[model samples]
Target chain A: MALPHAIMTALLEDDMSGYELAKAFDVSVGLFWRSSHQQIYQELHKLADRGWLQCATVAQAGKPDKILYTLTEEGRDAMAEWVLGESRVQEGKDDLYVKLYNLSEDNANHLTAEISRRREHMMQRLYLYEKIRRRHYANPVSLPVRRKGVFLALLAGIRQGEQFLAWCDEALAMLGTIDEPVE
Target chain B: MALPHAIMTALLEDDMSGYELAKAFDVSVGLFWRSSHQQIYQELHKLADRGWLQCATVAQAGKPDKILYTLTEEGRDAMAEWVLGESRVQEGKDDLYVKLYNLSEDNANHLTAEISRRREHMMQRLYLYEKIRRRHYANPVSLPVRRKGVFLALLAGIRQGEQFLAWCDEALAMLGTIDEPVE
Candidate 1:
């Protein structure tokens, strides 16, 4: 699906071996898309077979040679077509919301604990987003055209994390007031 | 995987025929978890075979008999267990972000139109969520224990939609200022 296109974009920025691509995915592309290294490697092979990507083998001293992947002319054209195509709204499936919808009074404590744990994770992500914003987009008003889209995406992530943290506080406060029946 | 759980949650609330369940899914459960009617029907059959659900054939006036699905005791227990278990964070895969990340200067007009289209959809969702909040959760503080969880989930949806709309506005504003080169 989009994974192939995502890989193409990453390669367009710079060619890298499979190992480097996996590491880059973990830090950057993985934020919006989650993929295992095994999946990435499989897709790389498929892209090469489809003539969308070219591979160059680099010999290393006393080690196995690494294959670097780069987007071919066909790959770049495909990405351009995709960028101009219509996109459907992404519907995200969240199990936590399903659990919340079905939660009974008996599971109040568990739900509260889950909310707290999720809040901690959101806070950590928020901190990281803020750090990136300050470092890369300190002056949003004068951002280069190429970087504006990226800055906007980061903004969306930061706001989403903040909204989640706020919801966690609201849920915790409401749950605190409900008196649990002593078993 | 979560579809089975989502179906169980819906059936727990009320017994419904397959057609009815499909319609209800579009308006309610579909907000957090989306499933096609074919997939829902397939899962319904699997759930019945697994003894997690029981189906009864009911006669209707001037129509063929319909099978209605209800949750069994085993199904309820399974749902309870799932509710209390730890849930991993849901990673949302947005293709729009991928497109934005790779967009070249030549595609600025297309990206702008796509952003506008997405914003309109988000606005409509925000309106619907607000209407639901006003009608169902008018006084959330005085809600029954069972309804409180649903209310919180609704609040989360409303806030998320609002955050998305806000981000869309910011993106639009930034995109408007960039002048595309004439071909």
Candidate 2:
């Protein structure tokens, strides 16, 4: 329900500054739970206030001092407990589905174009996830306990992406054969 | 972002009272796009005020007259234009992914139990979708333009549900083999 719990999992690996954390989320953690720079910084402060995350200032010779965020023991405890808690399964909102739901002979061609564009986009994302898998999780089955979680999480996205591409293919093919409406 | 467009698509099939519209959403339209009853009712009023939907009163001898909603030409125009408009592809938020991301030796078993429960739940949903497929979309290949859209929309949810079950299986299998944390 909250971003702190997700952020704690992101911080489990190593200490990171707010900027670094934002970047990390943009690449990995953000894939599941999205957060903005302002949001991550705000939550970081709130977590530190709750004694869940400890913040330390690292001096930089040529720039402003960097505040690094480290997950506290309390943070890890909170994350571990949250991990085992009952969570809701979400039905995600996709506008493409809305278009498809309203598909008619009139808009079939237009909708298929949009779907084709989406297919390309999904493929790019799959490529990115595959690159991540190869570079980071080359051997998922043999990964240690700590590392396995990240691999599986990324795998979830990869599987969804693959499934999405298939759906797009199914849609495009079906829409391609629609006859013009009899006016 | 607005539910009105999606609700308009639902009303395109037949004129229905707010109650009927809500029920229709629960069964079919709510797969990719979800809406609460209150939200649906509110959006219906907004669409009527916008002159996109017409509300007609039908009297019942035994009960209060029901106001049924029908999509106007303007509503069709709106939905048509909106369908052709560019929209974002979303990465949905799923808590299971977060839990899997945090998976470690300590919580592996507990997490897998939750995942197993989710797997069963997903199977139930798949069964329901399959029933819908059999009852309605028996011949997807030959469906008319008006009907094909609904079939494809339902197909998207089925595909995603199938992909989710696969992800759950992957997570459970991996977590099942995790080694205890070295103290």
Candidate 3:
């Protein structure tokens, strides 16, 4: 999907500078989609050039002038059309599984290493999810009063991370038994 | 990180062809890292050229010859070093989040439409995960008992998919509330 489509859609909700847009992405829709700062800047220019987004130069003290971006009428129409055309399946493109599938001959040690790496990685995610939950509980948003959805999504992230960790434990045990060859 | 590094690491575990690697990535590591078929193919060539990987040409009766890749000592060393390196935090680079971060000023109706689109997506994932689970339960692999680690990883995939689906439901509810704001 074009970055401009998502970018313009977000702008239709509120006006924001590029920096703020980047931050907001991390908190919300970021669960599925992502972009780099450079990519964001590029998309912003493309959207504005295409007349889908309007930019107003706002003066700031000390810092350079910020360009505040908002969606135009055309942009809204484009975003609406894109939303309606959205599909049901979001197929992820990932790499780790590819290595696992190409199992030529069994090497128990390599498999063990991979499992160990994944376990550590899941632990890190669990920690991060916990932090997000704590932040939410401590400073509840006055806006979005019905924020059960956000909470649920965060919980899902935490649970999924924990689930992987548990699986790692089971996998490690299974691997241990395999490593012990019968005489 | 470089695609070659990731691919080489996978080879260190076991040898695989380019096509097999592509499919495996979809099922396993797709949760964290992503790679394109083109990138994987390119990496194979590069690695072989550098003597890090050697390709054995296989003769097929009626099909094109396929090159099976195995790691060299240098490739194994590279992968070992990479595996021991400090793992970086998984950054939020999703395009969907970038879009949402810019949504505060958007038309509520449009945003709601997008949320609904995402909800349908989560349901689709739920269905796919269930199918995979059923397949495994129906015909369990005949490998030694110790081989359950592979299945454990598969189960992890199903759970992660379900978690995302649950989160989508919550997000939909929040979006619905915002669509009809209280005066």
Question: Ten consecutive residues with minimal summed lDDT in candidate 2 chain B?
Answer: B89-98
Better of 2 and 3 by lDDT: 2
Q: DockQ, per-model, please? A: 0.73, 0.69, 0.22
Residue A117 alpha-carbon offset, candidate 2, angstroms: 1.7
Q: How far is each candidate from the true structure, as Cα RMSD in Å?
A: 1.5, 2.5, 6.5
lDDT of 2: 0.84
What tens-digit string does per-residue lDDT give for candidate 1 at B109-159? 898899889988888887888888888899998988867887888888888
Q: Name the top DockQ candidate.
A: 1
TM-score of chain B of each: 0.95, 0.89, 0.70
| Model with the higher DockQ, candidate 1 or 3 | 1
Runs off by more than 4 Å, candidate 3: A30-32, A88-183, B5-36, B91-152, B165-183
**i-RMSD values for every candidate model:** 1.2, 1.6, 6.0
Q: Runs in model 2 with CA error above 4 Å?
A: A61-64, A179-183, B57-65, B179-183
Interface RMSD of 2: 1.6
Cα displacement (angstroms), candidate 2, residue B171, comes to: 2.6
Candidate 2 or 1, higher DockQ:
1
**Overall lDDT per candidate, in order of appearance:** 0.85, 0.84, 0.62
lDDT of 2 at B182: 73
